[model samples]
Each structure stands twice: as C-alpha cells, then as structure tokens.
Target: MKELIVLTFAVPLLMAFLLPTISRVSFTLSKLIAPLVLLALAIMVVCIWNFHTETFVLHIGNFIGPQGIVFYVDRLALLFAFAIFAMTLLMWPWYFEKDESSDTRTRKLSLTLLLVAASAGMSLSGDIFNLYVFYELLAVASYGLIAAGNKKPAGNSYAAAFRYLMISALGSVFALLGIALIYFQTGTLNLAHLSEMKELLNNPAGLIAFVFILLGFGVKAELFPVNSWVPEAYMASSKRVAGLLAGLVSKLAVLVIIKALVLIYPQDEARQLLLFLGIAGVIVGEFSAMKAQDMTRMLSWSSIAQLGLVFIAFSIPGKAGMLAGLAVALHHLISKPAMFLIAERWGGSLQNLKGRAQSSPIMAALLILFALSMVGIPPLPGFWVKFLLLSGLSAQQAWLAIAVVLIMTVVETNYLYRVISSLYSRDEQQSVTSRHRTADTFSALILAGVLIFVSVQVQTVGQALDEIAQDAVDVKSYIDLSLGGGS
Candidate 1:
C-alpha cells in the first residue's frame, strides 16, 4: 500500500518518458496511455484511502530525513492526491476531442501527464525544497499545456502562457529565497525539522521568509493581487486545459500551501496577513467575476474568490481551521471542474446560457447541478463545507472577514444564478453550434454524479476530514513519525 504512493505519480511520469519513442512507433498508443494511466492512479489512491492511519515519511534510497527527498502522505495529502487524479481522469476523455495532429496530441498528452505527476508529487513531498521542485515542475507543465491552446487559429493563449511563465518564474525566485532563508536559519529543509525550529520561525528573519513563501505560492493558488493571470490563462486556453488549471493545479497548490502552514506554524502576524489576503480575495474576486462578460473569465474570478475563502478557513488556528480548509478545498475541487467542463462544451458567456436548456438540455443539467452546488444550497457537500468554514471564523470572533465572505457569497450567488436564469429565458438567443454529446458531456455527468454521491455520504466524508485536520494540527506526530527511528 505504501508503495502505491510512489507509483501513483511515477506511472504517468514513466509514461511521459516513454511516450515520444512510443509515438514514433504508434501514435494511437501514445494517445491512449494518458487516460489509462490516470485511471490506474485514481484506483491506487482510492485503494490506499483508508490505509493511512498515521502520518509517515518514505525516504528515497533509504536515506535518513533531511539528508534526501522524502514523501509525506497523511489523510490530507491522500485526499488531495485522490482529488487530483480523480478530476484528471474525468477530463481525460475530452482531452483529445479537439482535432489536432498525432504529434500535437501526443505532446499535449505528455505535458498533461507531467502536470499530473507534478501535482501528485507536490501533495506527497515532505521537504520544503523538494516541494518547491515539484512546484516548479507544475509551473513548467502548465506553461506547456496553456501554450498548446495557442496552436489553434485564434486566441491569446501564447500571451497568457507567457505572462504566467514570467510571473511564475519570478515568484519561484522569491520562494527559493524563502527556502534559503529558512535553511540558513535552521540548517534543515525537512518540514518536520522546520517544525522543531520555533525560535527561528518566530523571529524577524523567519517572518520575512514566511511572507516570501506565502506570496510565492499565492501566484499559483490564484490568491488576490498575485492572481492577475487567472482570467487570462483560463480564458485563452482550451476548455480541458482551463479545467485542469482552474480545477486541479490551483487546488493542489493550495494543499501544498496548507501543508507548509501546518509544518511551519507561522506567527500570529503572518496568519493575520493571510487572513487579510483572504478577505480581499473574496470581495475582489466575486465582484470582478460578477462583472466579467464571459463564463470562462467569470468562473476564473469565482475560483480565485472561493480559494480566498479556503485561505481564510485554513488561516484560523488549530484543528478547526484545518478542517475548514479541507472542506473548502474538497468542495471547490468537485464543483469548479464541472463548471469549467460545462464552459468548455457549451460556450461560457451570459448569452451562451440563453436557450441552453432547450438546445442542450443534458449539458444544461450538468451546469445547473454544479452551479447550485457551488452556491451552497442545502444537502449538497458545499453547504456543509461552507458551514464549517464560517463556523470556525465565527467561533474565533473573526467577524469582519466572516461578514465580507458571506456578503460576497450572495453576490457570487447572484452572478451564477443570472447565468442559470439565462438558461431558461424565452427570448434568449439560441446558439447555432451543434450540440453533439461527446466525452466532455460524459465527463461532466460523472463529476455531477460524484457530487450527488458526496451529498449522501456527507457524514462519512466529514469524519474523515476531521481526522486529517487532527493530524494536520499535530505537528509533533508528523515529526515523530518521520524522524522516529532516528540515526
């Protein structure tokens, strides 16, 4: 079971390596490998779902902690890994839907596979430096994936991709500086080791490093101010590519940031900084998304806003905050991808929704279901998840931020409902585009089905998340488990 963790990521990476050669021999074989790899990885992650009862580290080459790379997998990490593979699997069938030559499709497959491996690796990384390596890996893969959409006749894909790459590269430098500062202070890069260095962390230098790291990852997480790339990148890219960036990459980045927060235990001032960012993100993202003309840009802003709430949820101290963060991340993971899938298949604009219910009822159903879930109506997983986030804030007397999030949620609801309302308008213009049911439709339906499943199993999922949160707060346990059998 432990071995599955390594293989979960390694499989796609292996496929990526062999793909070019295989393409020369059989292009069809290359195109077929990605979905199969993703499907297998999803199965392995599910198999190990209930297997993690303790947080432990897997050292490469049998090397001791802080001396080499180590993989970390607690329930939180496992949950993110599971979500990444699951979402990617759903997007698999639609990947080749766009008509591209064999070589182009094969290259896209390789990069997409690389992104999968990077995301899975990021979730399991046990050291801050190793985590950065995977972070850069994720960024590189994303640049390629985003650029692939540019290969089409028209769009701003290249410009968006270039902006993302430049900004991301600059951000990585800050992150590297932060890692260096931490290493300079503590002489260790292991997260467990960093947890033991409280003296350094609470100091001025440590505080500076914390800021660097947070804002650094902020670029990827689409957190406010740093997330200018969100709309452009999503808008310029293909639906499948947009879905992967918005749904999987950003969420995995959030998980990685959460992991760092758990291990580092930043100062109160730092937490406050993050809390403030959350407030701004929610308000600004919702408002901006509301104003956007296109569904893709609108959903992009909405994603930034929702992730802001995630930041707020996790920023709260102790197990409650951790639990809130998990719920928010999980909820966004389920809903955002489906919404993007809809946007991809059906055009994503206010007008695009017009008469959609009549012209493309099946896709309409998928959009409506996901949109309702996102707005947090009762009995859906989102409602329960959001309840946990606000409850945590209210308990902490974080009233100001709580009020802003709730108010912005209403605005968020309005725009989404506006889109929904347009779906059934009698005078709305009907699109001439043919609505043939394809892999995109099936993939979205599968995601919607998962949302329904989650609604029914809410209690079971909550209990599991609670356990992960508990482990997340117990920094000592992570240290002991990883460094327990010390030299």
Candidate 2:
C-alpha cells in the first residue's frame, strides 16, 4: 500500500517529464498515453478505496534524515486524489475527440499532465516546503493552460495568469517565511513534529507565523478579499482549463489550508481567523456570483463561495463539521467541473443557452441536476453536506451565519433556475450545433451518472467523509501518521 502511495504520485510526475519526449515520437501516441496515465491513477484510487487504509507516508529520495521530504496518504488525501483522477478521466474525451486547434491539443495534454502531477504532489506532500513546490507547479501549469487557446483571448489569459502569479508568489513568500519561522523556533520542517510543538507556537512570533501562512494560503484558497483573480482567470481560459482551475486546483489549495490548520493551529486564535475569513468569503462569493453575466465567471465565483462553506465547516471544530466540510468539498468537486464543462459547450454567455433544453433534453437535465446539487437540493450529496454544516452552525447558535447561508441558498437557486429556464424555455428558436453534440452529450452523461451515484449513496459516502473528516481534525493522528508513528 505504501509503495502504491508513492507510485500513484510518482507515475504522473515521471510521465510529466517524459511527455515532451513522448510527444516527439507522435502527437497521436502522446494523446493516447495521457489517458492511460489517468487510468492508472484511477485504478490506484479504486484499490486504495477498497483497501480502506487509515494513513500512510513515503519518503522520496531520502534527502534528509529518516523523516526526509515525505508523501503522506490518508483518507482525506485519497479522497482528493479520487476527485483529481475522476476529473482527468472526464476531461480525456475533450482531447481525444474534440476539434481543438493543434496548439490547443498539445498544450492541453502537457498542462493536463502537469496539473495532475501537481495535484497528486499537493495531496501527498507531508512537509510545508514540499507543499510549496507543488503549489508553484500548479500555478505555472495553470498559466500555460489558461493561455493555450484563441490567440486574441490568450492576452486576457496571460494578464489573468500574471495577476494570479503575482498574488500566488506573494502568498508563497509569506508561507515560506512562516516555515522559516517555524524551523527557527522548532528546528523541524516535518508537519508531525510541528504539531507536537504546539505549545512552542503560543508566543508572538508563532502567532505572526500563523497569520502569514494563513494569508498566503488564503490567496490560493480564494478566501475573501484575496480571491479577486478567480473570475477573470476563468473567463479568459478555455472551458477545460477553467474547469480544472475552478474544480480541482482551487480545491487542492483549500485542502492544503485545511492540512495546515489541522497540523499547526488546530485550536487557537488562528482558527478564529479562519472562521471569520470563511464566512466573509461565502457571503461575498455567492452575492458576486449572483451578479455575474458570463456563465464561466459565475461558476468561478460560485467555486469561491462553496470553498467558503468548506472553510466554515472546518471552523466548527468537531467531527460533524469536518464531515460536512468533506461532503461539501466532494460534492462541489464533482458538480462544479461538470457545470464548467457544460458551460464551455454551451458558450460563456448565459443568454446563449436560451432554448438549449428544447433541443437537447439530456444535456438540459444534466445541467439542472448539477445546478440543483449546487443549490443543495434534497436527496443530493450536497444537501447532506449543507445539512451537516447548518446543523453544526445551529449547535453553536450562530444565527446570523445560518441566516446568511439560507439567503445564499435562495440566491443560488434563483441564478441556477434562470439558467435552467433559459435552457428549457419554449420561446426561443436557437439552433443546436452538431459541433457541440459530442462534447455536450459526453459531459452530460458523465455528470448525470455522478449525480445519480451521489444521490443513491449519499449516506454511505457521507459516513466515509465523516470518518475522513474526523481523521483530519485529530491532530495527534495526523502527526502520528505523517511521522510514521511519531518516533
């Protein structure tokens, strides 16, 4: 299991570097190979799921002591890995069958592989500095992916990517500085060791270190005010890239924040800061999404809002809230990417989708199901997640927060209904193009399947997520797992 844990990440990374060499052999061959890599990842995730392991870690290359830079695999990490693999699997058809430009195809394959490698690395990384390495890899791959299509639009993509780069760089510097501070104080970069030294982090320097790390990671997680780059970036990128950014990359960053919160500052003033920022992000992201004109931009804003909910879940400081957070994270992980993919096929403008459902009921139904899931409709996995989160808030008697969430639910429903109505409305006579049939049908079927799967297994998956969430909040467990039983 440990060997597989290392290979799961290693294979994709090794493939990322080997891709250039593979491409030189033949573009067609490279295209074929890309999906094969994702397939391997998917199989590995299934194996892990069946095995149902608790937590495992592997030290790669052993550059330092016995506990050198490590890749940790736990249920939470595995959950994210599963999401990454699934997204990659769904995205494979776009490259395999779509009529994308040659440049777009090449860039897509390369960036996709890079994104996978980065995400796998982020999920598995057990050290803060190693997390930084993967985060930078994700950012750079995103820049290239965003700029890969439509030369004219590439300018906007480049601008957005550059903005994202600058902000991400600032965050990275803060995080690195915090790591340095931690090292200075505790003399260890291992997350497990840092967690054991929580008493040592009670001073002013430690507080400053926590704040810096929070702000830095908050930028990537799209927390509140630091998330201004998301909408523009999504609008500028191709649909596939936008889906990857909104659905996978942003979530990966948030997961890292959760890891840091659990390990370094599980119960302190730092947790309070996370809660406040999370509530702020939810409110701002949802309201802003309600006002968005472009579908891609709207979905991007919605991702920020959903991430806020995840943060809030983590803030509640209990098994229930953690479970809820995991559920919401997983639900959004599946649904948002599906929505972005659909928006891409339908065109960016909300107005363009008018009467689409009349022409293609299957696609229309799929969109409605996913939209409803986003809105937290009953019987959906999202509903269970929201239910758990709201329950947690209610237990704390946070009425104002609950009110805000309820209001956002209404706003979310309204905007999503507007899209659904536009698609199914009978007044318009917009012709459905044949070009979109393959992409739209494939995406719709896959999304519909996922929605159904979640609907049927909500209780089981919710239980699994709850256990994972509990594991996440157990600081001692995380530490022990990361350090191979804490020496």
Candidate 3:
C-alpha cells in the first residue's frame, strides 16, 4: 500500500518524461499508455480506499526524519488522488483537428500527464518543500496547457496565459517567503513537526507567514483578489482545459490550504480571514457571472463563486467545516465539468443560444439538471451540500455569512434561469448550427450519472464524508502517523 501511494505520483511523473520518446517510436502506442496508467492508478486508489481505510504514512527511501520525504495517506488524500486521475482521464485531449500537428498533440498529452503527477503529489505530500515543488510543477503545466489551447498562432490564449503566469509567479514568491519564514523559525519543514510546534507559529510573524502562504495558494484556488485570471483564461482556453482547471486543479489547491489550516495554523484569525475573502469572492463571482455575455465566461465566474462557497465552508472549523467543505467541493467537481463539456458546442453569446434546445434536447435536459443541482433544489446533492454549509454556519452564529449565502443563491438562480430560458426559447431564427460532439456528451453523461447516483444515496454519501472529515481533523492521529510518535 505504501509503495502504491508513492507510485501514484512517481509513475505519472516518470511516464510524463518518457511519453515524448515513446511517441517517437509509435504515436498510437503513446496515446494508449497515458490513459492506461491513469486507469491503473485510479483502481489502486479505490482499492486502498476500500481495504486500507486506516490512515498511514510512507517514508520515501526508508528515511524516517524531517530530513526525508514523507507522504501521509488518509482517506481524504486517497479520495483526492483518485479524483486527480479520474478527472484527468476524463478530460484528456483525445481529439485533434485534422490540421493539428502531431507535435502539438504530444505536447498537450505530456503536459496533462505532468499535471496529474503534480496534483497527486500535492495531495499526498507531508512536507512543505515537496508541496511547493509540486505546486510549481502544476503551475508550469497549466501555463503550457492554456497557451497551447487555441490553434491560431496569435490567439488570445497567449495573452491570457501571460496574465496567469505573472499572477502565479508572484504567488509562488509569497509562498516561498512563507516557507522560508517557517523554516527560519522551526528549522524543520515537516507538517507533523509543525503541528507539534504550533505554539511557535501562534505569534504575529507566524500569522503573517500563514497569510502569505494562503494568498500564494489562493491564486490557483481562485481565492479573491488573485482570481482575475479566471474569466480571461477560461474564455481563451478549450472547454476541456477550462473544465479541468475549474473542476479538478482548483480543488487540489484548496486541499493544500485546508491541510495547512488544520495542521499548522488552527486559529480564529486565520479562519476569519478566509471567511472574509470567501464572502468577497462569492459576491464578485456571482454578480460578474450574472453580467457575463458568453457561456464560457459565465461558467468560469460561477466556478469562482462555488470555490468561494468551499472556502466559506472550510472556515467554520472542526468536523462540521470539513464535512461541508467536502460536500460543496465534490458536488461542484461533478456539475461544473459537465457544464463545460456541454458548452463545447453551445458556447458564444447567450443571445445565440436562443432555441438551442430544439436542436439538442438531451444536452438541454442535462444542462437543466446541472443548473438545478447547482441552485440547490431539493433531493439533489447540491441541496444537501448547502444544507450542511448552512447548518454549520448557523451553529457558528455566522449570520452575515448565512445571509450572503442565501442572497447569492438567489443571484445564482437568476443567471442560470436566464441561460436556460435562452436555450429553450421559441425563436424560429436560432443560429446554432452545431450539436454537441458525441464523445463530449458521453463524457459529460458519466459525470451526470455520478451526480444523480450521489443524489439518491445522499445519506450514505454524507455519512461517509462526515467520517472522512472526522479522520481529517484528528490532528494527533496525523502527527503520530507521520512522525511515529515524534521520535
């Protein structure tokens, strides 16, 4: 099991480098290998989730101290590892235009593999150094993927990528500064060690370090004040790339923040800071989405709002916070990606979508289901997710947050209803000429199926998420498993 945990990241990292060479030999064979490797890793994660429900630690190279690399594997980590592989596999750029070069295809494939490797590593790493390394790798892969999304040489994707690159680089600097401060104070970078020395980080300097780290990571998590890149990047990139960024990568980034919060900086000031930013993010995202003219940008802004909701849930503290955050994160994971897939064919000015349902009824129905789920209609997973969040906020007496969330839901429903109305309008002069690709629709259906299945089993899923939350917040268990009694 330990070896498998290592293999989750290691194998993909190795395969990413080897893929170009493999393509030199047989292009077809190279294509087969990436998905095969991802499938194997996904299966491994599922098995671990079933059989090794207990939390464990892997010390790479049998190195047992703060000097060595460590991977802490709990059910929460395993679930995210599985999501990285599964989502990457689903969003893999399998289709290319007839004029598209073989080199472009290979480059995209290699970068996707690198992204999977980095995302998995970020989820499992037990030390700050490796997390930073993985985070940088994730950023590089994302930049390349976004820049390569559009086929035209002078496409707007480059401008979007450049903007994203600048913001991400700045964030990286802040994160590094935070890590240096941490190391300067503790002489150690291991998370378990940091948790044991929380008092040392409870001071003002330590608080500053936490803030720097949060803002750094917040760039990718779509946290406010650093998320200006979201709409531009999503609009410029392909639907698949946008979906991957929104549904998978952002959640992993949030995982990094939550891990830090639970392990190193369990303080009210930290939580409150997160809450304030989350509220601003929700306000900005929902209103901007409501005003968006295009489907792609609207979904992008909606993603930002959903992540804001995620941050809000996590800010509540303890198991309730964890449970609510997980529910919102996972639910958004399913619905947002599927919406992006639908937008593959339906993209453009909302005015252009008038009467699209007359042409693509199945996709229209799917869109309605997703929008309803996102708006928190009863019996849907999104409803229960919001219920958990509201319950948690109510318990904490966060009346302002409760009010903001409710108001935002109304704002969200208004925008979504407009899109639906456009799709189903009775305009006889509708200009939509293309239907959703069969392959894209099939991929979206799988995610939709998961959403529906979870809806029916909401109770079981909620209980399971609650259990994972309990395990996640058990700080002593994490420290003991990682450091072996801090010996």
Candidate 4:
C-alpha cells in the first residue's frame, strides 16, 4: 500500500519526463502509456479504498522531521487522488483522440501527465515547501496545456494563457513571501511543525502570513476578487483545458487553503474571513454567470460560485464544515467537466445552442440533468452537499449566509433555465454539420454515471466525508502524524 502510495504520483511525474524519449521509439506507444498509467493509478486507488482513516506519512530516504520531505495521505488525500485520476481517465477521449497535431504527441501528453502528478503531489504533501513546489509545477503545466497542444493557437488563447500565467506568477510571489515569513519565525518548512506554532502565528504577523498564502492560492482557487481571469481563460482555452481547470486544478488549490485552515489557523477571524469571502464569491460569481453570453464563460463563473460554496462549507470551524466541503468538492468534480465538454462540442454560445437538444437528444438530456443537479434541484447529487452546508450554517445561526445561499439558488436556476431554453429553441438555419459524436458523448455519460453513483451511495459517502472532516479539525492528530508524534 505504501509503495503504491509513492507510485501513485511519482510514476506520472517521472513518466512525463520519459515520454519524450519513449516517443523516439513509438509515439503511438507513448500516447497509449498515459491512459494506461492513469488506468493503473485508478485501479491502485480503488484497491486502496479502505486506507486507514488515520493519516499516514511516507518520508523519503532517511530524511525525517524538518530536514526531510514527507508525503502524507489521509482519506481526503486519497479521495482527491481518486477523483483526479479517474476524471482525467473519463475525459481521456476528449483530450487525446482528436489532437493529432503531434506525430509523437509527447508534449501535451507530458504536460497532462505532469499536471496530474503535480495535483496528486500537492494533495499528499506534508511539507510546506514541497507543496509550493508542486503548486508551481501545476501552474506551469496548466499554462502550457492552456495552449491545447497547439503551436499555432486560436483567437485570444495566448492572451488567456498569459493572463493565467501572470496571476499565478503573482500568487507564487505572495506564497513564497509568506513561506519566508513563516520560515523566519518557525525555522521549519514542515506543515506539522508550523501547525504546532499556532501560538506564534496567532499574532498580527501570523495573520499577515495567512493572508499572503491564501491570496497566493486564491489565484488558482478562483476566489472572488482574484477570479477575474476565469472567464477569459476558460473561454479561450480548449474544452479539455477548461474542464481540467474548472474540475480538478481549482479544487486542489482550494484543498491547499482548506488544509491551511485546519492545520495552521482555524481561528475566529480566519473562519469569518473564509465565510465572508465565500458568500461574496457566490453572489458575485452567479451574477456574472447569469450575465455571460457564452456557455464557457457562464460555466467559468459557475465554477467560481461553486468553489465559493466549498470555501464556505469548510469554514464551518469544525467537523461539519469539512464534511460539507468534501461533498461539494466531489459533486463539482463529477458534474462540471461534463458540461464544459458538452459546450465544447455542442455550442460555445447560448444562441449557438438553439435546437441543439433536437440534434442530440441524449446529450441534451445529460446537459439538463447536470444543470439541474448543479442548480441544487431536489434528489440530485448537488442538493445534498448544499443541504449539509445549510444545516451547518443554521446550527451556527449564520442567517445572512443562509439567505445568500437560498437567494443564489434561485438565481442559479434562472441562468441555467436560460441555457435550457436556448437548447430547446427552434433553429431555422440549422446545419447538418453540427453533430455529436458517440465517443464524446460516452465520456460525459460516464461522468453522469458517477453522479448517480454519488447519489446512490450518498449515505456512505456522507459518513466518510464527515469522518474526513472530523480528521481535518483534529489538528493535534495531523501535527502528531506529520512530526513523528512530536518527537
């Protein structure tokens, strides 16, 4: 199990480097290897489904403590690894099948594989510096992949990529500076060590450090105020890039924030900050999405809104917060990517989707199901998580936040309803060229199946997420596990 844990991420990171060499012998082999490796990873993840609820840390070599880099896996980390690897596999057809631009197809494959590795690494990191390293790696690959494996990019694509790069670069600077400040105080880069230094970190300087780090991650997390880049980037990038960004990358970045909230600073101010920002993000994001002219742009805003919910969910300051956060995060991962892919193949703009449902009724139905789920319709996968959030807030007497959520639910429905109307709208100028492919539709159906799976096993998943959430709030346990039982 431990060896598989090590290989889960390391294989992809190392294989990405080997892909260029592999292409020399057979690009065909190299391309196939990506999915095969991912499939193996997916299998490994399922095999280890019953990973010990207690946190497990794997130190590299003889290194230990502040001097050593350690990779840690908890249930949350496993869940993250599982979601990312599986979704990338489900969406494999969309990414690899159509792009025949490279004879070897090594560059995009390498970038995609590395992106997966980086996401996994970040999730499993126990060292602050190591987390930052993985983050930078994720950022770089994301920028490259935004080009969609093309040397000659499409309109505004380079600009979108550049915007993402610029924002992330700035975020990196803030993160490094915060890291420097922490190192100056604690003289250690390990999360466990730093987590135990909450006394020192509770002061104004510590609060500043938290702000810097959060803002740095905020760029990638698509948090409000720092989320201006979402529409442009998702709109300009390919369907795969948009889906990846909206689905997995942003979630991992938010995971960093959640871990920070748990292990470093779950104080009143921090929780309030999270809640305020979260509510603000939801309101702002939904309004923006409501105003969007293009489906990609609208979905981009929705991702921001959904991430805001994740933030609010985890901000509940205890076990409930963590559980709600997990449910929301998982639901978004399963649902949003399919929508982005559908939009890519079916319609870019709402108007373009007129009579689209008539053309591919199955896909249209899938789209409607996903949209309804996202809007928090009853008995759907999305509603349960939001219900968890509302329950948590009600217990806390956070009436304002509750109001915001309820109001936004209606607003979400209205915009999604608009898209549905567009789909059903009559098109006099319909062209036969606009058609849906089975391969593309099949991947989305797999995602839909996952949603049903989530719905069916909600009770089981809910309990598991609740346990993980409890684990998050149990900061003492994380500290002990990370620092080898406090020496």
* TM-scores of the candidates in the order shown: 0.96, 0.93, 0.98, 0.95
lDDT of 4 by residue, 307-375 (tens): 999888877878878878888888898888988878876545577778888878888898889998998
Question: Candidate 1 — worst ten consecutive residues by lDDT sum?
Answer: 91-100
lDDT of 3 by residue, 11-86 (tens): 9989989988999998899999999999999998898888886788888878897788889999899999998888
Measured with C-alpha atoms, the lDDT of residue 138 in candidate 4 is: 95
For model 4, give the 10-residue run with minimal summed lDDT. Answer: 147-156
Each model's lDDT comes to: 0.82, 0.77, 0.91, 0.83
Candidate 1 segments exceeding 4 Å error? 93-99, 150-155, 428-430
CA lDDT of 226 in candidate 3?
95
Per-residue error (Å), model 3, residue 255: 0.5
lDDT by residue (1-487, candidate 1, tens digit) is: 6766898788889999889889999987777767887887788887787675556678867787667777877887787788788788777634454577778877888888888899988888888898899899889988988877744546578988999898888889988998899899999998888888766778889888887888788888988878988888888777777887777888877876777777785568877888999889999899998998888889999999998998999889989998898788878877887788778755545776677678778877777788777888889888888899889999999999889978987998899888878877775344676674577778788888889998999899788778778887888788887776542
Using TM-score, give the best candidate's number. Answer: 3
Superposition-based RMSD of candidate 3 using all C-alpha atoms, in angstroms: 1.3
Candidate of highest lDDT: 3
**Count of clashing residue pairs in every prediction:** 1, 0, 0, 0
lDDT (C-alpha) at residue 325 in model 1: 85
Off by over 4 Å in 2: 52-54, 62-67, 96-104, 428-437, 484-487
Candidate that beats the other on TM-score, 2 or 4, i.e. the better one: 4
